[model samples]
Target: MGVVPTDNELTGTVRSLRTSNSGLGIPKLLATLLSSQPEWSVSEKRLRKVIQRLKSEEETNFHPTSSLNSALDVSKYSNKLKPILFGPEKGKGLVATQDIDAGEVLWREDPFVYAPPWEIYEAQMAGTASWQDETRSNLTKGKGTSNKLGDESPLSKDAIWDTYRSFATLRNDQRWSHTSENDLARSQLENTFRRLHTVLINALYLQHSESQEDVTFDSTNTGSIPAPSRSAAHTKQLKRLLRVPIPEATLNSLFSWDGLMEGLGKMSLNLEAHGGLFPLHSHLNHACRPNVSIRHISPDGSTNSILHSPNPSRITVIAASLIPAGVELVVSYVDPSLDLRSRRRELRAWDFGICQCGRCLEEENSNSNTEHPEISGNRTKIEGGDERDVGQLEDELRGFLSV
Candidate 1:
């Protein structure tokens, strides 16, 4: 023998042999594709097929196994606020298991589940026929997606869409891309991260829509999702319309709870805001003279989470306002001093039937009759001649409050 091989050496030889030779013959460039990954070293089984192909000499019934089982994740920290609902249960509603106090920070949560923008586009293209038709009819066609962020010459659309976010793909997608020049091992090993602040911000906005009209795009115009226009400029404009923001601002301007007002009328749940959101706070029933109020803390310059931990990735919920025994713990979602009618309207939009709480009933009884001066219309008389214009009054109220 050239050299007497030990058991370990013999095993190693057999492995190399198994990798390089298949039943018919050895493999070709497969070895180069897998073994020379610039990122990290390949495992035995990982290189087997490539080696076999390079050798062009196959073995009988060869199978190479590797230690590439998927990693297991068993963390129990899920967003516990599963069923955020608005309802009028003759039942006690979402009552506080413990007492809450004023200036207390309630819990917060990542409200909206975010998906990659590319994935969003893909899903929309697949189901929404309007978007697909519009895209295909364009001179650019599929090129609408992968353009660079800025194309100075474009009359139509700019190119940012086609740019693949490698980090997002790695974290969520495992369909291993064959197009990239980077080695598979290197790509897999990369720990790059990109912040998705926009999704969080949109979630905040969705929680409270300051511009009521933004709630729904009055789809009276059936020509939704834009018709294909010949001009690249118009196509670009349509593209812009289709895009949602990618990053959300750290500071989100607060909205007085128009929705909360309606909830008060329905006596559904009382919710108070101490700044951050909470697990079950939204589910609290409403009482006119609620026990809780939302008090916003000052915003910091950089992005911040409501949670007070050293690493504020997760949000925390604490009591902002106090709750009382047998008080049905209500908190104001919007400004507290709203008159009964406006309050009822707001609650109605929030899906509450009516405000039957003590305060609301009192106001309604008073507005209906002049005899009870005690409840005399709670609304101040408009001293000017514009008293009859309830519509104007509504507009003024909405404008002043920024709801």
Candidate 2:
């Protein structure tokens, strides 16, 4: 038998219905609400929590995200690189699952995903399914408190824990904001995010002090710039950073953190930090002894988002020097702008172990006074440098040295 609706349920359902009218929310459009399917089989507990959210939302009279809603068409998205080997740690490293040859486009993806309307995330915050119960339970018991639930505690002294939504502050995967789905009768995100947390979230969440809502950026692909969104209290700080990277500037405001040491212990989520065309030059992973290398080729007139290749149409990975198959593949993470030490530091920060690829080892063994004739004046760094220049020069040799 169907369960009878409580007063809260009846009132909440009607209120929820009204907030979603075509004029307010996209989902409320007549064609959508009347013909939608039931939500997927989330647990009953999570479902009731959603009901509670409806009641809360109904009471708050929260306005829809009209600004974000009307901008991009909710449907259209590009499938550039459908990401393969995701990072084993906190959204950092990804590897090729299959053997990829030189010059092949290894992987490409839009990398940006649309997030659920702020309403859904807020509901999850208030103890709805996906995140609410999980966050409260985890926080009260203090297990995953690394996500940092300082003032926001559990709904009651006794509550069941759920992990789904708790990860918003815990993980750093850019993909969490993915807006892949165009239409759905039921919520399209719960399952996708659960899977995403697997690929990205870390257990040791580090805390920062930024307001998540105030951060915004322009789409490099679409060229759409947005003014930063911030609470009233942050107006001064935002003004100070008007021209600085809007994203990095807000990192300090992040109120949570990830604790797991990425790439050191367990595998974490690997993600694309920036989206652009990475020529074959971006593919190499160098070892102390290097085998492969990368070089950014800027054709006559290409924008920062696009690059031109020397060989007209196609780009390929090559043995900058003779590379044996058994050696690890390596690339210089920096563009041509980086010096040796700079290159090394960048790789170390990203958690790659010291490169000991074949080429790096060979240079050390040879110990030549001068570089190999083939390498002199070569724009690309075929192999990591040898130890010959390390201790003696120390600080002077910053880029690829001792990193």
Best candidate (score: TM-score): 1
Off by over 4 Å in 2: 1-101, 112-260, 263-330, 335-353, 368-403
lDDT of 2 by residue, 201-244 (tens): 22112122443222222123222222333446677776877857
Candidate 1: lDDT of 24? 24
Global CA lDDT of candidate 2, please?
0.36
Writing each residue's lDDT as its tens digit, candidate 1 over 251-333 gives 22122243334334333222322222332333445666665443322246233222222323233344545754333545554
Best by lDDT: 1
Instruction: Predict model 1's lDDT versus the native.
Output: 0.40
RMSD in Å for candidate 1, one decimal? 30.3
